[model samples]
Target: MLAHHTLTGPEDAPVLVLGNALGTTTDLWSDFSLPFRLLRFDHRGHGLSPAIDGPCTIADLAGDVVELLDHLELRQVYYCGVSLGGMVGMWLAAHTDRISRLALVCTTAWVPDKGRLDERIAQLRSSGMESVADTIMSRWFTPLCPPDAVARFRAELLNVDLPTYLACVEAVREMDLRADLVKIDVPTVVIAAAQDHATPTELVRQTADELPDSELYVVGDAAHLAVVEAPRTISVILDDHFGNDLT
Candidate 1:
């Protein structure tokens, strides 16, 4: 069974499955503060989930998500995925009938070619996460964000396991859901940090274009971690996407 963390809003509210980016935990979504039944799980090696030998593939990540859904006995869910989570969300919408709404944040439909992921994992494995975490937070932070935001991200990332960190990086390297984009048949929203160096705005726009029913929103005041740089903007985006509809 996938060891997971869950947050409650109302028992009757719609279930929202929240997944974080690589090398992070459910705490990344803690600021979301939505009024739905929020479910979060660490990838097999990242959080409370056991670090088992598994190839980091898109299918593998998607399978983990399915396993979580089955474990929770959730019939259908609204998905909120960032980076790795977004890749999994793409797969879920394409292959699963149970996803009612989909939201992709700071992610592209294709894998990142620069191998920044491999480098990141190697850094975590050898020198420890604190050093890499600093660099990552710098990349994720906007020019206007306070310096302390980076410190907070660094502190939280110190708890991640190195092997689990590598596993997720491999997953990110292998992901490419562009061909499967049009298979999505549900309401969808694509959000990008306009200043996102990790996932350029053009890539987000291209990814959004493939969806038959999707809207794109670019939050200009943020970098890769929009939830941190501008929480209220992210909140507004979610509010616009998911209003009074538990149906």
Candidate 2:
């Protein structure tokens, strides 16, 4: 349980925890270059972290973060998460005071299509990750995305631990954070991909609308993995949101 993490940037800088999406490890944030201390980690069983045998909730995943912060002696930090990672960010901001600022990228407060998600989970369980890897990769990026980037992400998806991925998928399937948005009092930014079919722009908008204090930003020509497809745009948005208060 500590969740394998790499903390970089200035030692004395404000801590900014980066959460990874489902099927992704800390490498998902490899492109980021910001001022604050960046803490990136792999979810349980995803990378070097140990996986649990049974199912878990988003709060359970978020608790891993709390435990990681405690181990590092970090009291409060800016948090940014993509997809499943964003789900964790929402939970942390709503339930704990550890998060000072929040950025949710290409994520929703709840799964809008439970039937579809259930079907996907069933497919993965019955057929394996290979059977659904192409479909998942297709949704991660638009056709305009570079082939190299697509290949890289596809490989990352393939390398994920099947059991843990399913566990996280179950977490998403059972998750319902619509009511908790109001409790997240920190300055929050909800980033969406205009062409993202996984977590559409409207859903992201709804999440921002529910949050008591939040703003919405949509990145064009990108799909679910907008952070990878448009690293510069994502960087600028994050820097503007988190860099303003370095004190």
Candidate 3:
């Protein structure tokens, strides 16, 4: 089962499942302070989750999420994911009826540059995560982000297992969900970071347009991890997406 943390809310409150980005732990969701029964977990091979054999696909990750919910005896949930996590959410929402609502943050439906991912994997193999932490950090957040938080992220990056990290990287590199986006029927909200170099606003907009029922919101003054950079704004948008009961 996936390693997960759950925060209790009202007894009858709906569960809100959260997924994190690649190379990061469930701690990525720490900034979010919502009233829903918040559930956050590390991807396979990241954080407290056990590592599996390498080269798992995005669908594999999505399946793991489904298993986690099943293990907890939950059949339906409001879901939110960022970056790599967002890709998994797209897969789940398109292929399953478990997700009642979805929020995709700083994510893309298709990988824009496969070459970049190849280079990243090569670097990781040759020099490890420490070699490119700074470069990744630059795109992960804006200059205004607090140094302490950035430091914590760097620590998490370095701590990730090489095989697991590589497997996740490969999954993202090979991920192409453009065609699947049209199949998603659940209500979805796509939140894009205005200055994000990773996914970019246009990619997120394209994802929103492809989905049968979706809305796009571009948040300025933030980069890839808009949830941490603009927690209050994101929380507001999430509350709206999940409805007034979440407030």
Candidate 4:
């Protein structure tokens, strides 16, 4: 099971589950605030979670989330994910009734850069996480990113298990969920980072357009890690989307 942290709320509060991006952990949402029971966890092979030795699919990762929720005895939750997390959220929201509402932040409907992902895989296999730290950080944040946040994310990257990290990279490399977007029936919010090079604005826009019941919000001046880079804006958007009495 994934390592999870729960924020206790009122007895009858709807659960809000937070999923981290590719290389980060639950700390990715350390600054987020909302009035619900918040559940945050490390994706498989990330943070304190058990590692996998080889490649896996986005559905494989999403299955881990299902197991996590079941293990926690949670019947339903409002879900949010960033980048890779968002991909998994899309899968869950489409394939199951567990996710009551979803907020996909800086995520895409498919892997648009297989060639780039191949290059990243080669670099990671050769020199480990440090090899692409600068490039990833550059795409992950805008110039407004603070040194401390960058440093913390850098540390998170460095701690990743190499095989497990590569497995997730492979998942991103193989992901193509465009055909599946139409199946998502729940209320969804697709958030884009204006400066995001990783997912790109157009890709996120298309994700919003494909979902039958989705709202689009773009945050200016942030990049791939919009939730971390523009916490207040992201938090407010999430509140407006998932904070209603939909539960």
Q: In terms of TM-score, which candidate is strongest?
A: 2
Q: What is the alpha-carbon lDDT of model 1 when measured against the actual structure?
A: 0.80
Per-candidate clash tally: 0, 0, 0, 0
Q: What lDDT is reached at residue 132 by model 2?
A: 92
Flag the better candidate by TM-score, 1 or 3.
Answer: 3
Candidate 3 regions off by >4 Å? 244-247
User: Clashing residue pairs, candidate 1?
Assistant: none
lDDT of model 2 at position 226: 92
CA lDDT of each prediction against the hidden true structure? 0.80, 0.92, 0.88, 0.88
Candidate 4 local distance difference test against the native = 0.88
TM-score of each: 0.91, 0.98, 0.96, 0.96
Top lDDT hit = 2
Residue-by-residue lDDT tens digits, candidate 4, 1-247: 5555555666677889898899999999888888778888888777788888767899999999898888889888999999999999999988889998999999998876699999999999888889899899998988879988998998898888888889998888888899989999999999998999999899899899999999999999799999888899988888888877554
Off by over 4 Å in 4: none
Q: List model 3 lDDT by residue over 158-214, tens digit each.
A: 888889889999999889999998888888999999989988899889889899988
- In the range 89-146, model 1's lDDT, one tens digit per residue, is 9998999897989999999988556477777767777887777776777667876888
Measured with C-alpha atoms, the lDDT of residue 35 in candidate 2 is 84
Task: Report each candidate's C-alpha RMSD, comma-separated, in the order given.
Answer: 2.0, 0.9, 1.5, 1.3
